[model samples]
Target: MIQLHEQGAYYFDDQIYLESEKKNDAWFDPEAGKKKTMAYKIMQAHNHSGNDRILELKFDSIASHDITFVGIIQTAKASGIEKFPIPYVLTNCHNSLCAVGGTINADDHFFGLSAAKKYGGTFVPPHVAVIHQYMREMMAGGGKMILGSDSHTRYGALGTMAIGEGGGELVKQLLNKTYDTHYPEIVGVHLTGKPKPGVGPQDVALSIIGKVFANGFVKNRVMEFIGPGIANLSVEFRNGIDVMTTETTCLSSIWATDTQVQDYLTTHCRGNDYKELKPENGAYYDRFITVDLDQMECMIALPFHPSNVFSIRELNENLEDILHETEVRGQALLEGSDVTFTLTDKIRNGRLFAEQGSIAGCAGGTYDNICAAANILSGKSVGNEEFSLSVYPASMPVYQCLMDNGSASALMTAGAIFKTAFCGPCFGGGDTPANNTLSIRHTTRNFIHREGSKPQDGQLSSVALMDARSIAASAVNHGLITAATELLQEEKAIPKYFFNKEIYENRVFQAHDQIQKDLPLRIGPNIAEWPEFNALTDDMLLKVTAVLKDPVTTTDELIPSGDTSSYRSNPIKLSEFTLSRKDPHYVPRAKAIREVELERLAGHDVRQTDEGLAAVYGSIQNHFPDFEYDKAIVGSVIYANKPGDGSAREQAASCQKVLGGYANIAKEYATKRYRSNLINWGILPLITPDEIELKNGDYILLRGVRKSLEEGSNRFEAYLVNEDLQKINLGMEALTADEIQILLAGCLINFNKKEVLV
Candidate 1:
C-alpha cells in the first residue's frame, strides 16, 4: 500500500515523480526552488540562521506533560529563567494517578500549577486533557511551530509544524534561547485514493511506519503531506494518522490545510488560527512516500514495535506461521530473562484472542474515532469472557460531545467502560493487562513492558496496535482477533462535533501574563534538587558498564516509564532504575563506577578502591607518557548497536548522567531527541564503527577529550586500556555550537549558568 522513492522527487499537481521532465532545466534554481515546499516556508519563517543549511528555531509555543514539566521548569529555573518567553502549556496527564508514588504525582501537579502562576504559563489540571489535545484545541496555529516535551507531539493535520523533543529543548525556549539544528530534509508523503471503510487512520499510519521505520527513510526529516487524497479524509482522520508519525522517527511533520482543517479550528473556536497551507506546484522533496489509501487493510503491529506491522487479513490467513515467527523473535528479545514469553497460547481454533482492548490517547481517542467505534459496537456487547474494553476520550470537550451525542451511551451499553481524558494507558501507567495475556490497543505504541508487565518479575504481556474500529470489532467478538471489514455494515453517520469550551474555562488555569512572584512551589519529599555535575576534564577514562547488542533499544528500557514516571523529578532516585528493565545489572555497575569517581574526587588512591583499574591506568600511561592518572575523570559508558528509539523523555539520558556516565558509544542513535538528551546531559554521544567490538568492563582512555571537543575535532583517538591497550577511533556526529558549550560546561543547565554569570 506504500511505496518509497529512494531518490529525490518532485511533486506536481498532487502527484510525485522520481525524476521530472523539468529536472536539469536551465531555468530551475535549486536554492530558490526549495521555497515551493511548505516546510521551507514554515522553517524559514522561524529560522534565525542567515544560512539555509543551519536552523535556529524559536517556536511559537511550547508544551509539557506532568512527568516532564517539573524537570523542565527546574532546569530552566536553575538557569535563571524568570518568566516564560513564549506560551508554555503544562498538562497533568501522564502523572494523573497521584496515588502511584504516594503524593509525589500530585505534588508534581501542584508544582506545575504554582510554576505556571509564578512564571506566566498555562496549566491544565489532571484529566482535563492530554497534552497534545490541549495544544491542538488552544495552541496550534496554521504555519506555527510548537516544541513539546513528549514524543508524540505531532499536530501536522492542522498545518502546524510540531516537534516532540527532550525537556532540555523546552528549557532553552523558557530561557529565550533557540533550538539549533541543521536544516532537516523534507520528505513528501503523497497520499492517493480513499481508504477502505474498515481501514482507519492507524492502518494507514502503520503501513507508512512499516515501510519507513526499518530503513530510516524519513528519520530526522520533515514529513510534508501533500496529495489529492488529503481531501478524502476528515481532519480527525488526518489527526489520527499524523500523531503516530513520531514512530517514524521524523523530526517534525506538516500538512496542506484545506477547508476541513479550517472548519476544525473554527469548530474549536479558533478560526483565526486557521490558514491555508499547501506546497507550491513544483515543490521538490528529498524522498517521497506514496500511500495508496484504498489498498490499506485492517492492520496490526505485533508485539514489541509499531513497525512490526501486518495486515489483519494476511495474519489470519497465515496465523500459525506468523505466530511461530513472532514467538521465535520474542525468544531472542527476552533471552537470558526469567520470564517465558509466548503468543501461541493465545491461539485457539485457528483464531487469536486478546485479553484487553483500549481505544485511547492522542492517536485513538479522537471524537470521530471513538464515535465510529461506538457505532460499530452499538448493539453488540463485548462478552465478559476474560475480555474487557475501555475507551478514553482525548479531552473533556470530546468527552462532553460524545456524551451529548449518544456515542458514549452506545459504547457503555455495549459493555465498553468509558473513562475520563488521561494518557496513562499509552505509557504503561493504567489498564495494564494480566500476565501472559495479549492486548489490542489503538494507542501510540506497543513496546515491550510498555503495558506495565514487569518481565523481570516474571510478568510478561504483549500489546498489538490496531485501529479503534478494528479494536472495537475485536471487542464485540469477545477478543477473537477479527478485522473490522469482516463484519462490515452500513457506515455510521458521525454527528457534527460541538466543542464545549466551558470544560477548560472552569478547570484549566491560564496564568499567562499573570506572574505571581510569591507563589511557593508545592514540593513533595520525593522532589529533589539536581545533582552537581563537574565540567569536562582535560582527559577521561570511561569504563564500559553495559553493552547492549539489541538492534534498537527504546527509552522505556532505558529508564522505563509507567510507575517510574512519578520519580522523574528526583534525578538520583530515578537513576537507580536506569536500564533496570533491560539490564538489571546496569545500575549496580554504573553505581560502582560512580563510587570510584567519588573516591577519586575525595583524593583517595584509585588502586585502593579497585585494583583492576590500577592496571588499566598504568596501561593508559604507557601510551601517553604525559597522561596523569589523577587528572583523568573516571566515569562510565554504555555501548549499544542503536540506542534511544522511543520517547522524548530526557531521563533516559539524564539517569545515565546521574550515575556518572560520560559517554554513549553506539553505531547510531535511533532518534534526534534521544541524541539531544545525551548532549543536554553532558554525555558524549560517540559514534563508533558498526564492526567495532567492545565489551563490558573494558576501559577506554580518551586523550585530550575536553580539548578535542572545544577545538571542534569530530574524531578522537582512544586506547582500550585492557591487558592489551589497543587504539580505537571514536567520534561525535553533528553537534551544534551550543551543544559543544553544553558539554564543556557539564550540561545545559551548567552551560546556561555560566552564560548568566558572564
Candidate 2:
C-alpha cells in the first residue's frame, strides 16, 4: 500500500520523481549556465543579519493552555511585567478536568481568570477550547507569527508562522525583547495529487515523517507547504497533518493560503485576516520533500515513537518480526528493564487487535476526524467486551458542531463516551489502560508511559497511533483489527461537514474589543511567589547527581505531567518532582546540593550547609587566605548523553533551576527548543567535548566563568576542586554571542531588563 524511493526526490512545479543525476541538468540552461532555486529568493526576501535579524515581534494576541499558562504568566510577572503588552488568551484545556490533584487543578483555572482580569487579558473557561484550535479559529491571521507554550503550536495551515517555545520565551515576548536567532533555512513541502479515498492526512504526514525524521533531513528547518495538492485537502485536513510536523523536529511551518483557507477564516468570522503567501518562483530550499497523495495509504505509527511507522498492510503481514524487533528495541531504549511487553499476543485467531481506542488532543480531537469516525461506526457497537472507545472533541465549538451534525448522537449510541477538550491523553494524564493492555489512539504521541502506565509500579500499557477513522473501524469489530479502507464500501456514505460559527460567538471571550482598566488579581494560597535568584559568580562548582543515556529524553519523563499539574503554580513545591519520575533518586540528591546553596546565600558557615563541606572549606582557607566559603555558590548538575527531546515545557529547566541546578552538561541536545529553555532559565547549556569524561559527583570549579562569558571568550579553564582545592586545566566550548550574554546576565529576562535600563 506504501512505497518509498531509496533516493530522495524534489518538486519543481508539478513535476516530481526525477533522478538526482538529471536534477541539475534539467534546471540548468547550458548556454547561459544559470541555475536558480527557491531558498535563495525567499531568504533574500526576509533575511537580515547581525542585530537586525533578531525580530522585535509584536503579537496581536497570545494563547496558552492549563499545562503551560500559569508558569508563563508567572515568569512574565516576575520580570517586572505589569499589564500585558498585548492580547493574551488563557485556555484551560490541558488541565480542564478536576479529576487529578484534588482542588489544585481548578485552583490554577481560577488563578488564570484572575490574572486575565488583573492584567487586562482574556480567559477561555475550562473545557471551552484547546489551545491550538482556539488560536486557529480566533487568533491566527496572515503574515503574523504566534508563540505558544505547547509544542504542537503549528497554525501555519491558516497562514501564520506560529512557534511553540518554552514559557521563558513567551516572557521575553511580553517584555518586548527580540526572539534572537540567526536566519533559519526554509524547506518546501511540495504536495501533488489528491489522497486516495480511504487515506487520511495522518497517513500522508506519517509517510513524510518516517522518511525524513531519522536522517534529520528537515531538522530546525521551516517547512513551507506549496503546490497543487493544497487545493485537494480541506483546511482542517491540512491542520491535522501540520500539527504532527513537530515530530519531524522542524523549526516552524507555513502554508500557501488559498480560497479554502480564506473560507475557514471567514467561517470563523476572520475573513479580513486572510492573506495568500508563497515563496518566489525560483525560491531556494535547503532540501525538498515531494509527496504524492494519490500513492498514500492508511498507516500506523507503532508504539514508543511517532516516527516508527508502517502501513497496516505491511504490519499485518510481518506482525511477528516487527513485534519482536520492537520488544528488543524497547528493552534497549529502557536500559534492559525487567518490564515485559508483548504485541504478538494480539495475533490470536489470525487477527491483530487492540484492547482500547482513543481519539483525543489537538492532533486528533477535531470536528472532521470525530465526525468521520462516527460515520464509520454508525450502527455498529464497539461491543460489550474489554474493547472500549473514548472520544474527546478538540474544543467546545467542535463538540457543538458534532452535536448539531448528529455525529455525537451516533457515536454515543455506539458506546463511545465523549469527553471535553483536554491534553491529558497526549501527555499521560488521562485514559490509563489496564496492565498489559494495548491501546490504539489518534493522539499526538505514544511515548513510553504517555498512556499512564508506570513500569516501575509493576503495571504497563502501550499505545499505537492510528487515524480516527481506522480507530473507529477497529472498534466496530470489538477489538478485531481492521482498516478503514475495507469498511468504505460502495453503499457506505460519508456525510458532508457543516460548520456553525455561532457557538464560538456565544461562548468564547474575544479580547480584540475589550476595554482595559487597572484591576486586582486574585491569588490563592497554592499560588506562591518566586524566590529571588543570584547573579553568576567568578567561580563555580557543580556536582553531577544523575546520569542518563537514553537516546532521547522527553520533558514528560524528566518531570511527569499527570501528578504534578497541581503544583505548577507553586515552584518550590513543584521543584521536588524534578527528575523524580525518571530517576526517583533525583530529589534527595538535588535537595542535598540545594541545602549548600541556601546556606551560602545566607552568609553562614559551611557547616549549616553540610558538615563535610565546612571541613573542606577550612582546608581551602588555610591554603589561600582570601578563599571564602561564604562567597561561593554550590549547585547540582545532570549529565545526559542526549536529552531535551520533546515538548517546549519550560518547567523542565525551571524545575532544575529552582532545585539548585546551575547547568546541564550534555553530549548534545535533541531539539533547539530545549536548549533555548535551559538558556532562558539561566541554566547553562554546556556541551562536553568528546575527550571529556565527567564522573558523577566530581566537583569541577569553573574559574573566571562569568568574565569569560562577558568578554566573548570561547575557551576557558576549569579546576577539579579536590580536597586540597587543587586547580586543574579543563577545556570549554564556544557559545553563540547571544547565548554568552544570556548566561552572563543570569537569564534572558535579566538581560532584557539590563538593556531597558541602559
Candidate 3:
C-alpha cells in the first residue's frame, strides 16, 4: 500500500520520474532547480537569511498553549523583550484544568491575559480552542509559515507551512531574532486512489507512520503533499492526516493548494489569506512516498508508540502472538519499575477487549471525524459492560456545530460521554483509565505513561491508537476491538460545517489594538521564578548521574505531562519532577552533585564534601598539575540511546538545566526540537558512539572545554576520572555560531541579556 523511493526523484506533468527522458531538454532551468518545490517557495517568502541553503526564517505568526506560553513569556521578558514583534496567540488548552494545583492553572490564564495586554498579543480563554485548531480557524494562510510551541502544530493541509518547536525559538522570534537552521530536505508524499468507505484519515496516517518512523525516512525533512489523491480528500480529512505528520518525525509539512483549500479558508472567513500554492511542474525531491489510499484499512498502533502499527483485521486474526509480543516489550520498557503489565488478560473468549475508547484532541476531534463517528453509532449503543467511551471536540465552534447537527446528542444516546473543547485527554490530564486497563484512543501519542497512569504509584494503563471510525465500532461492539469495515453499513451523509465565529469574538481577549501596559499580572503562590544558572567555565567536570538504555526516550518521560503540567509555569517547582517517571532517583543524585559545585563556589575544600568526588578530582589533577578546583565546573550528565521523541515541550531540557545538568551524551537525538531545547538551555549535546560503556556516577573531566568551543573545534578529548581513569573522545556534531555563543553565555536568555546591555 506504501512504496518508498530510496533515491531522489522529480515530479513533472503530475508524475514522478527517477530519471529524465531527455537529459539535454531545453525546458530544464538550472536557476530554478531549488526554487521548484512548494516548501522552497513558502520558505523563500519568509527567509531573511539571504542565503537559500541556510535559512534564517522569520515566521508570520507564533502560538503557544497554557503549558508553554508562561515559560516562553518569562524567557522573553528576561531577554529584554518590550513588545511582541509578531502576532502571538496564547491559548489555554493543556493546563485548563484549574483543579489540579489549587488555582495555579487559572493563575496561568490570568498571567497570559496580562502578558497579552502588556505585549500586544492575543489570548484565547480556557476551552475556547486547542492551539492548533485556533490557528487553523483564524491564523493559517496560504504559503505562510508559522511556529508553535506544541508538537502537533501542523496545518499543511491549509497550504500553510507550520512547525512545532521549542519555547526558546519562540523567544527568539519575540526578540526579533531569526530562527537559524540549514535548509531541510523535501520528501514527496505522493497520494493516489481514494479511501474506502470505512477507512478514515487516521488509517492513512498510521499506515504512513508505520512505514517511515523506524527507518527515519522522513526525519528532519519536509513532507510535501502532491498528486491526484490530494483532490480525493476534503480539507478536514487532509487536516486529520496532516496533524499526525509529527509522528513521522518530519520537520514540517506542506500541500498543493487548490479550490478545496481556498474553500476551507473562505468558509472560515479567511478568504484573503488564500493563495495558489503548488510545486513547479519539474521539482526535485530527496525521497518519495507513494501511498495508495484504496488499499488502506482500519489501522491500530499498539501501545508505547504511534509507529507500532498493525491493521485492525490482522491484529484480530493474530491476537495471541501480537499480544504476547506487546506484553514482552512492555515489560522491558518498565524494567526497573515496580509495575507489571499484561495484555493477555484483556483477551476474553475469542475477541480482544479494551476498557476504554476516546476520540479527542487535534487529530480526532475535528468536525468530520466526530460526524462520521456519530453516524456509525447512531442506532447502536455502547453497552455498560466494563467498556466506556468519551468524545472531546477540538474547539467551541466545532462543539457548537456538532450540537447544531445533533451529533453530540446521537453520541450521548449511544452511551458515549460528550465533553467540551479541551486537550487534556491527548496528554493524559483527563479521562485516565484504571490500572492495567487498555484504552483505545485517537489522540496524537500513545507513549508509555501518556495515558496519565503513574507506574511509580503501581498504576499503569496503556493506550493504543486507532481512527475514530474503528473506535466507535469497538464501542458499539462493547469494546471487542472490532473494525469499522466489519459492519458493512451504508455511508451516512454528513452535514456541512457552520463555524460560529461569534463564540471566539465574544469570549477571546484580543490585545492587538488594546495594549494595557499597566495591567498587573495575577500571581499565584505556586508560581515561582527560574533558578540561577552558572556559565560555562574554561574547564569542566561532569558526573554521569543516570544512564538510560531505552531505544527512544520521549519528552513525556523526561518531564511528564498531565497533572504535573500545573507546575510548568514555575521552573523551580517543575524541575523537581524531572525524570520522576523514568528515573525517580535522578533529581536527588543531580542535586548531590550540585551541592558539591556550591561547596567549591563557597571556597570550601572540595575534598571535604564527598570522598568519592575528592578522589575523582585528585585523578583529574594527576593529568593537569595546574588545574584549580575553583576554575572547574562540576555538574551532572546523562547518557541515552536516543532522547527527545514525543512532545516539543522545552521542560525536557530546562528541567535538566535547573538541576545542574551540563551535558547529554547520546548516539543521536530523536527530534530537532529536543536538541534545540538542550542548546537553548546551554546543555552540551555530545554525540557519542553506540558501544561506549559509561555508567552512572562515573566522573568525566574535560580540560579546556570552553576554549575549544570558542575556537570552533568540533572534537574534544576528556578523561574518565573514576578508578579506571581513561581517555575518552567526544564531539559536537553541528553547532551554529549562535548556538556556541548561547552555550558560552550559559543560555539564550543570558546571551540576549549581554547583547541588550551592549
Candidate 3, 198: how far from true, in Å? 0.9
For lDDT, candidate 2 versus 3, the one ahead is 3
User: Candidate 3 on 597-671: residue-level lDDT in tens?
Assistant: 888888888777878877877877776789887878889998999999989999999999989998998999999
TM-score of each: 0.99, 0.90, 0.98
Any residue pairs clashing in model 3, and if so which?
none
CA error at residue 745 for candidate 2, angstroms:
3.1
Q: Lowest summed lDDT over 10 consecutive residues: which window, candidate 2?
A: 30-39
Off by over 4 Å in 2: 1-60, 336-338, 489-496, 513-517, 605-630, 719-739, 749-758
lDDT of 1 by residue, 180-289 (tens): 99999999999889987777999999989999999999999999999999999999999999999999999999999999999999998999999999987667888888
Measured with C-alpha atoms, the lDDT of residue 333 in candidate 1 is: 75
Q: Tell me the lDDT of model 2 at 292.
A: 76
Instruction: State the weakest 10-residue window (summed lDDT) of model 1.
Output: 25-34
- For candidate 1, the per-residue lDDT at 662 reads 90
The number of residue pairs in model 2 that clash at the backbone is: 9
